[model samples]
Each structure stands twice: as C-alpha cells, then as structure tokens.
Target: MNRLYHESEDWVAQGSCRQYDPELFFPVSTTGPGLHDAELAKAICRGCAVRRECLQWALRAGEPHGVWGGTTPEDRRYMRRDLPLPAAS
Candidate 1:
C-alpha cells in the first residue's frame, strides 16, 4: 500500500457511493444495464471530494475491478499506459 492510501482512509467514508452495493460499481458485464450502472457509479464519484485521490490510488494499486474516481477499469488501464507510475517503494 502507498502512503497516500494509508493516509486517505477517511476519504472513502466521504465517497458518495459508500452506501451503495459494491457490486454496482463492479458489474459483471459491460452490456445492458451494467453499463448504466457504471454510469451511476461514476455519478456518485463525481460528487466525492476525494475523487482524484481515489483515482490515483486505484491506478497505483493496479485495481483490476470496480469503478473509482468516476472512471472504469478500461479508463485506468489507458491512464496507466499514458501516465506511468513510479515503482513502489
């Protein structure tokens, strides 16, 4: 885990989707209502104060699932490629 994550646990409590089902953010499919659910998850993230930090954590952690910082996994993958992170300490 990174220092930011260790220091940012409180931010997760402030996330808009905290009360929603975790599965909603991690849909099993990308088709049909699943896509809509992802958008809904993003909507919640947009309202979160720690959206940027959440995204950074997800990218650095190489999260393979779920929505974070209003972005999908595919979004993070592209980001990781375009904005390579430094090796973990």
Candidate 2:
C-alpha cells in the first residue's frame, strides 16, 4: 500500500480512533472485504476527534493497516495526494 506506518509522539486525540482501542481485537473491518468496509470505516470515523492528526500521521508515515482516527489507508492515500499534508506534530 501507499501508507507509511510509523509511530508518532505528538499524536493528540483530536477524537477517538479505533486504532488505539485496546478493546479492539480484530483489524479494522476493511481488510478482507472491498471498499464496502472502507465506506463503513468512514462512517465510523464520522465522530472521530483526532481524525486529521491520525490522517496526517498515516500520510506522512505511510501507515498501512487499520483505521487511523477515522480514515482508512486508501483514504489517506487520496488525501495525501490531494490535500496539503500537515507537518508531523
């Protein structure tokens, strides 16, 4: 994938991302299914607080799995290519 997975020390929870949910057992639901799950992931992301931060981290670091904040790896790919990426926090 186009994601760059790396850790960020400045990850502020602009909102809740399932990425860090200890209660989460399985990967975000998009791994197996097609973009259907990606759409679902986006819906779940609707209320996320740190969605931007998570997206930036993913784009800058090329995160590859699960949902970051709210957006998926594919979403990050589009955003990174389309929008101006934020600096690492």
Best by lDDT: 1
Flag clash pairs in model 1: none
Cα error, residue 11 of model 1, in Å, equals: 1.8
lDDT of 2 at 60: 76
Worst window of 10 by summed lDDT in candidate 2: 1-10
The Cα local distance difference test for each model comes to: 0.73, 0.53
Candidate 2 per-residue lDDT over residues 19-80, each given as its tens digit: 53432312445455444555555555666665666666656778766666566665567687
Error at 62, model 2, angstroms:
0.9
TM-score of each: 0.75, 0.50
lDDT of 1 by residue, 1-89 (tens): 12234455756666767678778888775456678888788788888888998888788889888888887887788787896633322
- Candidate number achieving the greatest TM-score relative to the actual structure: 1
Query: Alpha carbon lDDT of residue 24, candidate 1?
Result: 81
